[model samples]
Target: MAVITHDSAVRRQLRSGLICAVVSATSFGLSGPLARGLMNAGWSSASVVAVRVLVAAAVLVPIAAAQLRGDWNLLRRNASLITAYGLVAVSGTQLAYFNAVAHMEVGVALLIEYTAPIAVVGWLWLRHSQRPTVTTVVGAALGITGLILVIDLRSGLTTSWVGIAWALAAMIGAAAYFVLSAHGDGSLPGTVLAAGGLLTGGLVLLAAGAIGIVPLHATTNPVVFQDFTIAWWPPVLVLGTVTAALAYVSGIAATRLLGSRLASFTALLEVLAALTFAWTLLGEAPRPIQLLGGALILIGVIVVRRGELATPDAPDRA
Candidate 1:
């Protein structure tokens, strides 16, 4: 009876983790279109990111404080990890991605950035000697191939060297996100980590702007979404609260439950979700080939899952 109960508990945890991962992906997928609207209204990418991080921090810090209660030393203890998470995962990732988009088609840039999972696998192999099983290698290959198809990179693939560099940087940042989120054994609550990370990221962006490293222009003009123009704050609010706040918190929680490798693989769903959002919210219809590509990504994720199950003793670390 105890064994059966233990199995049931594990199943429940898996189910909840999967749900959180999907929710995180969905929320994150919304950022592209919503930010695009703001950009169209004359907000610079740096400004958009800064506001998103700042607003998210503002909302989450109080909650984190409440969660921490009197145990404030968690922040001091995990300072370095939180800083890396903020600078690399949150701030650097967004900045590099937007910079890449400026120089290349969004689809192409996104495809390059989403190659982070493969980078994650490679990083684990090189740094921690956590060699992937054959199934993992095959699944990574299929996932990358499917991503290429899903983005439909047959045309408009032209990009400058600088754009490629930025995309690669974004990929590194993304890999760091998953690896750091998964490896931390500290006692900090996920909410605290998310909040602290956002605050630090926001400050970094602000400092960068102050130093004239990136242009930080912003506008209060109404944003056009699908059929009509609406108040800019509405979309920005959603971007901060839902996309950044909820997405980061839930993503960390999912990573904690699912482990880094599986969680990163599962995050491939963000591309499909982004495509779907583009179709519904921005009226960009997906090609049938893209639909097939999405299926292949799902298959690749399943393959990776099976591989991990087959190698249960393998530690998940990078």
Candidate 2:
């Protein structure tokens, strides 16, 4: 009876985690089309990201404080983790990715950054002595292959050495995001982590913009969607509340439940979600090959999940 109850609990966690992971990926994916619209309207990428982060922080901080309930020790205990998450996982990754985009094909740069999952797999193997099962390795390979096809790298543009370096740096930061989110005690709620990281990262981005380290530019001009022009603030608000705040909180929650390995693999769905949104919002229809790639990504994630379940004792520790 005890064993049956434990199994039921595990199943519940898996179901909840899957839902959170899907929500997180879908929310994160929505950013692509909207952000592109803003950029086309003369807002710098940094400016868009800054607004997204700052607004999310403003909205989340109050909730985080409420969750803390005057227990300041939680904040003090996780001070370094919050700083590192803000610096590396949030702002630094975006900065490096922007630099890489300046130098290489955006698809290629994204592919590199997404390689962070592979890095997480390696980290677990080396640091936690959790060697990936053969099935996991195969799943990762399939996932990478699917990404290459989805991103259509066969016709990719030239990439400079500097671009590769920046992308690699982004990859490291992306890995940190998964590792940091998954490696934690029960004391820190996902909202608290999300809030702290957003606040710290938003301030860093604002500082960088002030010094011109990252160009800051935004016009009050109305932005256009596929059908009509809308006020800028509406989309910005959606980006903050849905994509930035909700996405991060759900992502951290998913990582805690599913651990970094499975959670990171599942995040590959974000690419498919982005493609779907682009098709809907920008009329950028996906090719047949991209559809196949999306299917492969789905299959790969399933395989990875099965592998994790098979090896129940696999250390997902960071």
Each model's TM-score, in the order given?
0.92, 0.97
lDDT of 1 by residue, 1-318 (tens): 997997688667667877889899989888878888899999988998899989999999999999988786878988888898999999898888878877888777888888888888888778877778899878877877888889887755686889999999999999999988876664788989899999999999989889987789988898987887899899999999998999999999988887677778889988888888888778889899999999998888888776655545445544
- Kindly list the per-residue Cα lDDT of model 2 for residues 1-318, writing each as its tens digit: 999998899889888998999999999999989998888788999999999998999999999999999999989999998999999999999889989989998888999999998999999888988888889988988998898889987654796999999999999998899999986766898899999999899899989989888999999888887877888888899999999999999999999998899899999999999999999888899999999899899999999988877666654655
- TM-score between candidate 1 and the true structure: 0.92
Q: List residue ranges in candidate 2 displaced over 4 A.
A: none
Looking at model 2, residue 147 earns an lDDT score of: 88
In order, candidate lDDTs are 0.85, 0.91
Backbone clash tally (model 2): 0
Q: What is the lDDT of candidate 1?
A: 0.85
Residue 254's lDDT within candidate 2 is: 95
Clashing pairs in model 1? none
Question: Which candidate tops TM-score?
Answer: 2
Candidate 1 RMSD to the real structure: 2.0
